[model samples]
Target: MSTSIATSHTATPHKGLPPGPKGTWIGGNLSQIGPRRVDFFLMLAQTYGPIASFRAGRWRLFLVSDPELIQQVLVTDARSYIKHFGARTFKPVLGNGLVTSEGDFWLTQRRLLQPAFLKTQVLSYAPVMAELTEAMLAKWVPGTSVDIAFEFSALTSAIALKTLFGLDDHGDRVRVDESLRLTFELLTHRLDSLFQVPLVFPTPANLRLKRAIADVNAVIDGFIAQKQAAPPGNDLLSTMIAAQREDGTQMTAQQLRDEAMTLYLAGHETTALTLTWSWYLLSQHPDVEQKLVAEWQRVLGGRAARASDLSALTYTAAVINEAMRLYPPVYVIGREATTDLELGGYRVKKGYTILMSQWVNHRDPKYFPEPERFLPERWLDGLASRLPKFAYYPFGGGQRLCIGVHFALMEAAIVLATVGQQFKFTLAPDAVIDIMPQITMPPKYGMPATLTRR
Candidate 1:
């Protein structure tokens, strides 16, 4: 049903909470959400209004689909909220990292790490991103189908490891890649299962998670120790190692591990999924693909893309932006209310969860015209300035905005420019590209596509 019709019947102005779809007594909406929680969020927004409320388990969950309300949650009144419970689950793999840490410690960590992601610092890694994409392209064979999602996963992981940790050897790549895969799988299992055993119980799944976390921690710990002994390099690890507190001390060993794990996880998966969806979208829209390829050809002239060439590759960047809008890598961003407050005209009690799904907001017809259509040209104009601030938050917004935003965008643009002109990928026959939104919205069965040399 149209949102206007649904809201007319569902809008709760005052003396009550915002309206949401019906739920059961025990599970509430939890049982109905299933694996594709994105669908449930969309249903909530469409069937209710910009502000929708529901219950998940015992907690009251609020989905803020309006851009204005999102701004309050992410920026204006951000001090009143902390990271939500769902995000805390990542603590097992990420430790007290920036992604999982909060309050004063998180602020301190952000200050220490912010310089490493400065525009100048991120630009230095452009050649590394381009070089790795070139290496990946070299391994592909024409007319053979491959799981592009897996390929991008490995490609981005290698780049993250090499540029951030200064680990370039095949063995290092393999070791880190395996550990990350296992960690992600364990997290996915925990997220998908309704009932989860405690990690201390020594269940098979718990043991596997422990092993994966150990493997990753060992790799990071070794990097820290090595960096401490050697002369510092320009890599992120070295930068962090060189940073000191007010009392002239570097981060503690555990702090180092936490930050390293956080960056490693955040840096790779989002970019990989962004490119994966870009390829899928380009495959489906040959016209847009042709436009992107034409832009690459005109901009690079058969040469590999350099960081300087990024500004000229406008259409290529738009393709990536449009793809991300349709399938945001970090689909849902959640925060918990610290005190009782009013949001979008609804009374929200203390401790209520606030959810902002880019997948829902990015597709809102109010902000983005023809929300279902892939129109990169829409971004080529002044549309960005015309839209509300939080309407297109793929990298999130406010002080907590992704520190790696510039890095991921540059990496994606460079990869597209480097690979777009040399190859064309088409979806394999009968291969369905479905989204499985776990940590990031990865393709459910992997993106099986036929790669053709251009």
Candidate 2:
């Protein structure tokens, strides 16, 4: 269904509430910030204090950085909003996937798929995670530099495709890469086309997106058909297929396709981004790196890291959190109001697409002392809990909280430990790092780091 557009803009002429920087009628302050979305948020925070408002393509976005304000929107009246165009724009590619769907459909799919990512189920995937890391490590030669971001991307791809879909070790790596490359292209092309026509048109970029969607859909279809023809199995595919509501109503094929596709995208994509920047942080802070390695030595002791090891690795976990504060994978969570609501003394009328940006909230100097510096020890000082839940949201908040929160954390810690115990990496000098904003934020320069066995 074509998404309903009620007001198409935050056109309300409200009287009371904090002031925001002025804007043009059509694009608002959107043009002030560069195309890099994160940079834009940072600029807005500098100009209009932590809480501000702006317009983007007819959407009235309240760009919030205050943890208290973030909590009001994400938790208090959360049901009043659902994923706005930012996320709903993904529906064409993701269908009713847990990340894209809304209403009862989203809630139901989330309930069914919830168990697959629970702590125990996630722990069950640890050995496979370890094996995959070692396999990727075997391909690496010591004292050689590699784009660690790309390597982690490929590694997570292998891990996700294997554990989630039960693909073979010698499976079609070429096909998977083709799909990933194309799907990412499609996602970005559409984002750039925000003011243009719908992307399903005959434009070159649109056609490329179409082709990429087909490439990925074909693989997903094949996987599901094979599973349907056989008996139930243990991988995420079978788990999603076999899942039933309390009333025993199983997900239909389309629903299965949606949920499976969601898992395929999320199983490792977000975690890979986290680990990629994490290694960068570790390289910049040698003391943190030394501490993490020491923790790995003391706890893992040349063995595979498990979910259980996460608690004891304070500095290591802090490094991950610190990296996320700088480079959050999901930089922003958007919402469209279903009712005329009053938020923080402001009239948030029906259809205003509010934006709660983690990129802004996390870097606010008030919450994070010297937000730019890499200080992992600050995290251990009960800093995370001292802040409100919505204050430092990397997984977001409320009903729409990321289902893969634990899954991503578990995967990251294990992979960090595995790689830390085995190798150390340093960034190549003068490497031009950039940010390519998409469904998730990723490093643009392809983080290259020289690696050697410790």
Candidate 3:
């Protein structure tokens, strides 16, 4: 779970820094942070100002809402920090994939994975997006409520798998869906305190996690070993397998397995969350929905959307950005300082944690007025131009920004555009959505929505 591979951290403290929430006897604000971590931080931002601190157990958690300090930590002095432990803890699940790992290895993996999703290359995958959306919509029954969140999770799962590994079997759809859903659910809870004990009795959660991981790993291992032996198409996975260093060293099978898991998880989860929230936002704002449909109708005219059409779907793109702003899939970006440094004239030492929550930053009135309202027009006319780059990083910032960002945006915009042209979704009557945070933000119990053919 160590972010920096168990290396000793280098963070210094400042003199008379801002006030923080005081700790109670045992847990401090750990329990208070609650299931709603994003809301918890936003409340702290309200109570403690832009820069505040709170105790999680004995750990001092600094809550940063200032863009300047975040820019310094993530970009200008990025090398002095690394991804936080929450991301690192998934290393067993993610391997040294782009989301996890540090130093040269992370760089190498990024390079290897980059080509598969180059801008030109990603555009070629648009047809797959269109096809997959249609395929999913074909199964929906009119007037029945479906969990659109679950629907998207499954949709993106299939899209990522097919686009990367070429799993196109109709019969395996249910199997694939179950494998990913179980893995997603297990990953969040399996690493908790109760399961951390060595040789402990298996709780139902533990048992479920063990079985789920075993199933997913077996499925992935089989596909990977098969691909390695036969060597198929030039998809993302194939490109990754073929990646070599200056010394001409390619990734080992184990590395390939790890990277595949990383891509699989990364490719689907965050993208699904983005699309899910987009659907929710669109349903709420009928005006935005009208404009979005107009754009789609003019662009596609009842035909399937291509990636090249992504630029023409500006509103669609803006809506995705706005949704990410309101409900960013990766709710936070954190780093552990390796060297003592002065940021915003405040001294912070090595090993000190600096966090910038999209939950807080995207809503700061200085950058976004009435940030809670789902308004995509705020992104038009280059309205977001004035803000610092790191001020809004749902996909993260810097060279470490998501490699699959183009893919996710293209997938979400294209699929939704194509499907929305054919069907309209309204929130299933009285469905209460609780945005749940785990490795990726998702609606708890899924966002049930009724679909109607338009």
lDDT of 2 by residue, 1-454 (tens): 0111122123554565345767778776666654587887777767766556777767777766666666777778787887787787677668888887778877877887777778888788888888989888888899888988888887887888777777654345547556766677567655555375677579886777778777777777777887778777788788877777878798888878777777877887789899998988788888889888888889989887876777888777888899888889989888888998765546777888778778877877767778888888888889987887876889988888888888788788889899889899988898887888888888876898788888
What are the lDDT scores of the predictions, listed in order? Answer: 0.84, 0.77, 0.76
Candidate 3 per-residue C-alpha lDDT over 249-347 given as tens digits, one digit per residue, 9 for 90 to 100: 887877888888878878888888888889898888989999988998898898878877878999988999999999999888878777776655456
Q: By descending lDDT, how would the candidates be arranged?
A: 1, 2, 3
Candidate 1 lDDT trough over 10 residues, lowest sum: 1-10
Task: Name the lDDT value of residue 189 in candidate 2.
Answer: 58
Q: Candidate 1 — which pairs collide? A: none
lDDT (C-alpha) at residue 446 in model 3: 84
Query: What would the per-residue lDDT of candidate 1 be over residues 1-454, giving only the tens digit for each residue?
Result: 2223122213454668788877888777888788899999998898888888888777789988877778877887788899887887778878899888888889988988888789998999988888888988999999998999888888898899888878774665568667877788788768656577889899988998999888888887876777778877878888887789877888887888899888987889899999999998888889888887777778899878988998888888788889999999999999998887677667667889999999998888877778989999989996778888888999999989999998999999888778887888889999987887777888888999898899
TM-score of each: 0.94, 0.91, 0.90
Query: Which prediction has the highest lDDT against the true structure?
Result: 1
- What is the overall TM-score of model 3 with all chains considered together? 0.90
Could you say which candidate leads in TM-score? 1
What lDDT is reached at residue 303 by model 1? 78
CA lDDT for candidate 3? 0.76
Query: lDDT of model 3 at residue 397?
Result: 79
